[model samples]
Target: MAQETAQQAPTTAHTAPARALLPLILPAALVGVVASLVFVGVSTAAEQLQHVLWGPLPDALGVGRYSVLWMFVMLVATGFAVGLVVWKVPGHAGPDPATLGLDARTMPPVVLPGLVLATGLMLAGGPSLGPENPIIAVNVALAVWLGRRFLPRTPGALWPVLAEAATIGALFGTPLAAALVVSEALAGRPMRGRLWDNVFAPLTAGAFGAMTTTLVFHPTFDLGLPTLGHPHWQDLVAALVIASASAVLGMCAVYAFPYIHKAFLGLRHPMLMLPAGGLVLGALAALGGHLTLFKGLSEVGVLARDPEGWSAGQFATMAVVKLAALLVAASCGFRGGRIFPSVFVGTALGLCAHALVPAVQPALGVATGVLGILLAITRQGWVSLFTAAVLVASPAVLALLCIASLPAWLLVTGRPQMQLRDDGTPIR
Candidate 1:
């Protein structure tokens, strides 16, 4: 009796009123809140472990926390741990993280445990990657698994969209980013409804997701740079130069990605490849200092706080090292995403631009710099715009970014994406 009733819930969430989006509202909002809860749980656990690994453990041993030598030790150890999970766990931690992006697909319920373990370790272990990719994967997997078990009548396809939107909203602390990304994904696909109607469910999920995450985390993206009241003609010129150059630099990384991934994969085992990548990352951390070590959100904050402290050369080196580390981390079997570390690279380069040309407003420098690098790497124009604008927290920066993004987009449009391809499909 319960089994039959459970098997049949609401009507297959397929039919909707032509004018109103009502059926998806409650389920999607609930999914969004629950997704944010999952994110907060995983991140909190990772942070606790991170503190232990980088703090008391080092102090007890009388070594400098996050020191050059300690970084080498911890990073190698972390690689070993993640490698073990990838090798021994089911689904091999749900595909090589190097091959994934915002479009990471859902996985089996069996794969979720190992995926969470691997991603959590990557986050705590200081692999220059972020939680965005794997968290999305995790949420999507869970949403599908649980949604089917409970809400069997919901259309199968809607689960992925709701999950992805919710995760993006939770990760960025704003539903707007999710809305833009979903809009981009929706375009060019044959669909039944109007754009706004189609987006209605995702927007609801994103709103709830963002709201829950913000209530829990109090996250903010602004950098506290001196605000620009109005855009200057020179600001446009400076933004153009910075954005274009940053895009080229990002392209260089994109070009190098396949070679790097091939080199690491050539090792033929997660154990050997990941540890070797760790050694290289240790060397990079030494050159770029501790700020280049982690996924880079807090480190970026530090950089923004003391923008004038580092020399231009120093900032440039940090940018290069972080970019290199991002490449290595992504290529070598680590379970994480590239966006946060890429943002750090852009931030450092933007600061370098400001250091070189004091005439450029620091906000404009960083915003355009981010715009260019994000465009080159993510190939998501709306993400590049949203993330960069959030950095400056200025409406005026948007105009400059709009102009600067034109050239940056041109440089990156025909280039290879940062991920390697597999038989025309993105590797899963």
Candidate 2:
């Protein structure tokens, strides 16, 4: 009877953990699905707005007349958004959309909604931020809330890990990336043999979320490549060189971006800061002849679609102007993701490279350069490469891009470690 009772005790203890996980897992998955759907809806809305507003706004703004006013408007809008976030949200806002690198576990939940709303505004209002990071942030927050509500007795760690993975997977449209992000976030933590089991629920949840995203909305960019001309050894070398250069630039961006953000934060009054940022943005927009006003995806598309429209000098000028505008807007407390601006910079750099190295195929050079910048700045190597390849419809170019991105990656390594609190604590 003693031995039987002992065995029963062990069984009871073992069953408890499994049973505890059940409630968390199921609710987490449902939350993930809902979050993904929300992301799809938001992304779709943003894209449609971009299309509708792009042409009309520019024409109405009348290039020179609107530039200053637009800048001021952007600043005011951004300040308002930031104020809302700071006042209402718990974590002061969501994740830094620019410095994202699989660190979701440490994220706070209260800032999710504000981040989402702010990001949507940024995107629709013509800021350079992307929708992906905000989407992931909201999803993770929602998952945590759902898990806590449903499984109050479960371990806290499980929900975050699962939620982050699911959200990342759904955002990236790839389970592999999501899994990798989760692994990175959980790095240094001691999970024992339970790590794999814990991830299982998240991975399943992520898969469900991704499927829902796919069914509800189509990706804005085509993620495919077609056969293209063979890449030469010289092309490969050029790509490598370009990739290295991009990485270096990326490192600079990562390090400088925070400071830029800080400058905007330092502004005591939103009324002054918003108008100032908008004015600067407008002046910069004038340099690009109105091309620099919006989120820059359309501008990138224009360059990609017609590589010859702008001369080398024009491309270089535009790239510099866009970068300056992005810096100013971001620094002035403009709410948005940095992804589109980075892409704009990459595209301009690629165009410049094509002009400098006439031996390289223009399309290939542009594609490679863009990919390299994406890899370096975002640290999302595969996604960047895929985006570049798909935009050009060329596998050979992608191969070259992959080779070139190495140096950029090497140069930019360890540059984005800077972290600052609202009161300037310098956390990282």
- The most accurate candidate by TM-score is 1
lDDT for each of the candidates?
0.89, 0.62
lDDT of 2 by residue, 1-428 (tens): 99888878742212236665566567657756886787777777766765545446656767433455555565356546655654556665554433443344345655766666666666766554556555665666666676678777766666656666666666656565565555554555765445555466677677777777777764444322224478788878877776666656665655676777667656765555555666666566666756665667666777766666788899888877877776665556544545567677777777788777767676666676677667655666556766676566665676677667666666655555323355543334
Q: Which runs of model 1 end up more than 4 angstroms from their true locations?
A: 1-20, 423-428
To one decimal, what is the Cα RMSD in angstroms of model 1 from the true structure?
7.6
lDDT per residue, candidate 1, 78-161, as tens digits? 889989998998888888776788987889988889988998998898889999899999989988998899999889899989
Global CA lDDT computed for model 2: 0.62
Worst 10 residues of 2 by lDDT: 219-228
